[model samples]
Target: MLIDTHSHIYTEDFSEDIADVIQRAYENEVRKIVLPNIDSSSVKKMLNLTEQYPQICYPLMGLHPTSVTEDYEDELQLVEFWLQKQKFYGIGEIGIDLYWDKTFIKEQTDAFRRQIRLAVKYDLPIVVHFRESFDEVITVLKEEMQPGLTGVFHSFSGTLEQAQQVVELGFMLGVNGVVTFKNSGMDKVIEKVDPSHIILETDSPYLTPVPFRGKRNESSYLVYVAQKVAELHQISVHELARLSSNNAERLFRI
Candidate 1:
């Protein structure tokens, strides 16, 4: 069985053929998918998707870093409200993102920290989104790292040192289609990290794998990522799938 740890199938991009997309995923051996909420606007859609496919789709509630802004406090409140009323699997798609716009940097940090505290309070794993702010994210995690403060660094694109730091902090590095890109340095770093500390994801409708690069990605394409990891470790695709899927199941308690 395969588990796509991060995917935004709720995005309008798949609204026209969501059932077909999901069917493709199952046909390709993807047994479970975890949908991470972006913000207040996406919460309802995410919940509805989970309701439609409860056995296969699990929902996570949290404020995405990029969604943080001057009015972030209100958004955080909304996240908290939903989290309190539901049994979400985790608290995430949260972290710091300075790639798109750094105007709300401070607000993003505050919101990330607040959400981290919430994860601790609720005893849930965090799915982090770090972009051009690895140092800052590591610093926060270092200060907050403790028993029960574990999570995955989603779409990890950092150095071996950074990956080591994250592992040291009790977090898994979320490997995705980026690992299949020829230009991505993930190949080198992933060679050093243990597969036990890694999880597979497609981040579908976003980072499609090679041969399908620049096109719409989907959960079914996760096999390409599995193939790449197998080649890197000189193992078979089945072994990579088993190890990676096991890692995801352990981390997410699926």
Candidate 2:
């Protein structure tokens, strides 16, 4: 079975047909979807989905970089509240994102650092989301790196050198639908990486793989990603599933 290490199917995009989405994912052998929180506003819906589909959906708690606003501390407080209240598979969907706006770069880094500390405290892996801020995110990670600090860089689209850096830092690379894009060039980078350091994800409701590009993404489409990554590594899809799923199971303890 394949594990979609990052997905937001709990979001409104799937509200109309969540059951169907989960069923499709299961049917496609894409079992165990990880739900990463965006912010306080998303916590309820995310947790609700987890509660409803406890077996297939696992939840992670964190404040996304884009969600870091002026009142981010309050949001962090809520994140801590949830972390203390219940069990979470990881601390994630958290990192620096300069692609959209850089006005809060300082705040984003601060929040990222704090959340990484939370991951360390809780003894859970992290699911990072960095976009156009690889240097910034890597800097923070290097500064905060410590024993028991581990996680995956969700939707990794970095160079082979960066991938090597992440692996050296003891983190998994989250490969998703983007690898299937005509010009993403992710396949070339992934080709040089070992399967043991890779994991599969869909980032559902976004980054849908080819043959279904331009359509709303879902966990079921993870098979396309798996197929592509398997081809890149020149391995069977079944073997790819085994390796990536084992990476996910170890990282998130799911």
Local distance difference test scores for all models? 0.91, 0.94
Writing each residue's lDDT as its tens digit, candidate 1 over 185-250 gives: 889889888888988899988999997999999998988888888888888888888998998888
Off by over 4 Å in 1: none
Best by TM-score: 2
Question: Whose lDDT is greatest here?
Answer: 2
| Every model's TM-score | 0.98, 0.99
Question: Residues 86-117, candidate 2, lDDT per residue (tens digit)?
Answer: 99999988999999999999999999999999
Clash count in backbone of candidate 1 = 0
Q: Which pairs of residues collide in model 2?
A: none
